[model samples]
Target chain A: MGAMDNTPIGGDTRVAALWDGLSRVMDPELDESIVDLGFVTDVSLDAAGRVDVGFRLPTYWCSPNFAFLMVDDIARELARLPFVREVHPKLHDHMASDEVNRGAHLGLSFAETFSAFEVSGTLEDLRETFHRKAFQRRQEAVILGLRRAGWSNAAIVSADLATLDRVVLEDEEAARQKPRYRELLLARALASTPSDRAFVTLEGAPLTEVTLPAHMRALRAVRINMEANGALCRGLLDARYGEAPAPEVPAHEPDHAAHACGGGGKACCGGCARQVSAFQPTAAPDL
Target chain B: MYTTPDGEEVFIIDGHTHFWDGSPENQKNIHGKQFIDCFYGYHSSLSPKDKLWTREQFAKYSADKMYHDLFVDGPDDMAIVQSTYLKDFYKNGFNTIERNHEMAQGQPGRFIVNGAYDPRDGEEALEYIHFLKETYDVKGVKLYTAEWKGESRGWKLTDPNSYRCLELCQKLGITNVHIHKGPTIIPLDKDAFDVHDVDHVATDFQGLNFIIEHCGLPRLDDFCWIAVQETNVYGGLAVALPFIHSRPRYFAEVISELLFWVGEDKLLFGSDYAIWTPRWLVEKFWNFEIPEDIKQEHGVDLTKEAKRKILGLNAARLYNIDVEAQKVRLKNSPLAVAAE
Candidate 1:
């Protein structure tokens, strides 16, 4: 798939020239040459040098802001050449979309088809995340109103996405309008899981440091909490090691709090200090 | 009704996470334990980005969503972080020390760093260990047995080189030393490794607050037996915990067994965050839908206090962090803005 055939465009210099022309018209968003990035799909050139070039949008339905920018770059570049007559953008799949492609293509050009206030999907993802964070943070309406009031980038990501479960937990009542909402609710439910073996017995001497001050680290919290709770069958081991001196290992930085998931390669804590291979299953869990 | 010193919540301590750049050229052989590829359920290639997830990315993604809500700066949060790459060490020095020391540093009882040491470097590794403590104020030290004189990429925490580093961690006050354990005799000898191989060495280094990296295959009870039997030894279920088909009760068995063996305090909190935990939780919701009550049975509290230790505190004390001052600073510390 990598090696490309440098087959010439044959006799028509315009066809070869059109191909050469679009390469320089690169996809601005990707920041790479368009031809090499496989964005330029097809190009047609007539004897009059009328060029019709087609391109696949970076996304299935990418906003055509960059597409039209390249369209103009093509027109200007081709118009500058001695032979070209007309230049038109030929979008194959994206332009035929239900909301965006068909709605605007009638009176508007591809570039003009976009809405200035169109909602960002990533922002929407962040919005949903903020809701979950608000609940986790107990912030409730704190930041939602901030975003609603048009604030800039600001958020509190607790726990690792690795430890978080991205489930749609919204019930039918709340999710009747938006089905995807259910998935979001379920995502954090997993977090409530005990992180270590949740020690219920309270056997150890009243904890050495009963209350922790506020200024702790902020690594994956929810997941670690869930993992810590889940990993525990009893409340806690005795703080006093009968024979063993305390490791006396000083504290480093706190990892993000509230995340329930772990990642690979970039795994934090060398795979969170415990990695059990699935291939070698142990005593079947009771859960 | 709900009141403990930490209050309602468990002392949440994360006890695990690594900070490192994917790039190899940070001038650190910390361990050629190159985190190359990971295979999870045969669908490893499903991810859009091929890069392995790191604590930084984990933090970047999870920061605002969870951290701000869960932690209050002081003992409210605790994390024991380790660095695989020497260049990737945490910049914060000992609690209230230089914020940019760039090595393993335990903050005002907040985030704590455990610097990685490669035994293959021999004396040089030992020297760096000293420098990390003396110069950077690194709190804890980390070593990997499988990483030393690595066999076909790796072997058990029981490996000889790992024992040497473990020797150092015990000698030093680096109690939070983490050891990695791969699958037992990975059918193809090429990938064969056993965490138990170093069991005897760990026994010899008794009293060092040692954590066996991966509980070495959750469902398997062999290592659990060792953790139960060993006096100074403790284990963490950082990865490969099956949460999907298993309900919260299903996990109780291993949790119960781990508690029965190592006792609860010895079992540190581990999410194996970037790699396994998130998906397991997702799959748990997808398949089992375990109830929250089931977790409470194990003494797991969803409230804020318990959240502190599991988040990082258990490791903090186990790591022997100064809990006394960490509490005072939380109220006055500027790093924390709001805490619920």
Candidate 2:
């Protein structure tokens, strides 16, 4: 269920739930799930309910702020799990691994974490900027999908949330991003009700037929930027950790025993060893 | 020079290349090792399988390999070898002008060595710019804004100290300013990757040409806006060009956007060598085309003339090279003679 696992199917709900939590956390800049991006390498829950999440980014020098955001998000998301007592998101190999891990553990704000660097802007501002981009990128995908489905620019710019909800896009990318776009759109209050226009600028201004072409070009720039960064992130991740076994896991008999660490299970054995080493109290920082 | 199927020779001026020793022995700390490893990641990731190099080879290659990779074997007619002195990361400094100039000495006219300076060094930075010009007679300088210096993670082009350095560069006739505004290396703040700084610098230093490397990807929208507003601004195709192999469609879309906004005359070819070679990139890019729909949407086309400009003509113009004269000189060079 997690990035490290060679198999797709697993029986342990506890560990799977941990992965599910990690999945909710994103790389902020890319606005993609950490799990989906192969950032989360190992997830294991001990008997004491202490969750240690092992992860690595595409590069050791990835922005420290982005690293902090992801690590902090991981902890926050995992805390939602019912049985999870404590969450430790272990970021490995990154230049800021120590600061980020310690900061996440102590619940320190990004400013407090690296106060020495004199971070110029607040993480909230950075987060907001990325939110706007994610909204735009996803919106572009959905809009392109509609355009591909033979919907005119007039139809798209004039369509309401009700119309968007009922849309059955044939385009795979648009269809996949449609719901995600809706979630962000509503979250950002760009559109709130069924009667609200589905397509609106990040500032909540509704798109007009005359402005649609220019607006689409603007959206496309955002889309292409995010897509390019996403591609680079995926490529770097694969290059950093020789490509992970195919992301898909095969469904088979649910072997509960095989799920246990050191129970001779191929999938969890390496993960379990890594878990033990990662959580060691005296684990020296690997340079 | 890259010869087309019809036997038309296309001169290539690779806008970016590096000669660095990121080997363990040179690494001052973990950041050093990780820095090169990250570059290796980019190398292994975007490069075709057959183009892959072993980690050891990538970490440190001989001078002969670099020359062959750029000239005798690769398609680059003239490679701009940019110096990046990560004194904090490597013991002897990574890819300093000393090393680049040493290598360029062998090839002479085939290499254009660009110098780099850390503005965070304050008055010393200004002195360093003078020193670069005095020593290398450099016409261009590469600014790696994300480079860490002591306690500072990065600096902006708008920084007061940086402005002073730019003034020195302007006076010294270092007309070309290549800034690394691509993906973050060790940035603590978003300002490092922000193209807004380029906007400010380009507008202020109208006399200098500002080439935003990587075309400020992930911030392409902002970069495009800036490039359109400022005529002196240009885009380097280092990190961006690799997409020709890994994501040709995305490359089409990006190139279309660049053509529409930055224009072919403002774009330059770069292999960002060692990470990727110039041979395959030049071949692939020459043959590539923006999808018809993208062309229509962007109202631009990647014409052969545009390709000729992007491949080398644009850069030759920036460096004040007379293409015909330089071609004659390069043809008579020792390497060219050896190849013949």
RMSD per candidate (Å) reads 23.5, 8.4
Which segments of candidate 2 are over 4 A away from where they belong? Answer: A1-11, A244-287, B336-340
For model 2, residues B16-108, the per-residue Cα lDDT tens digits are: 999999999999998899888999989988888789899999999878888889887898889999999999999999899999999888887
lDDT of 2 by residue, A114-212 (tens): 887767767887788889888887898898889879999889999999999998988766777899999999999888889999999998898888998
Docking class of 2: acceptable
Which DockQ values do the candidates obtain, in the order shown? 0.01, 0.31
TM-score of chain A of 2: 0.79
Q: What's the true lDDT of residue A242 in model 2?
A: 74
lDDT, candidate 1, at A87: 67
- TM per candidate, chain B: 0.64, 0.97
Question: Which clashing pairs does model 2 show?
Answer: A8-A249
Q: After TM-score superposition, what is the CA distance of residue B9 in candidate 2 from its true location, in Å?
A: 1.0
Q: Total clashes, candidate 1?
A: 158
Task: Report lDDT per candidate.
Answer: 0.39, 0.81
lDDT of 1 by residue, B1-340 (tens): 1123333433445555543333333223322112221112111211212323443343223333223322432223445556554222212211122322232232344566667676666688778777777765665665544332322223345546656766776676666567665321121111222345546866787757567765654223445656766766666656434322222333433444444445655666654433433233222322332234334433342333323333445676676656655556554654533233
Q: How well does chain A score by TM in each candidate? A: 0.32, 0.79
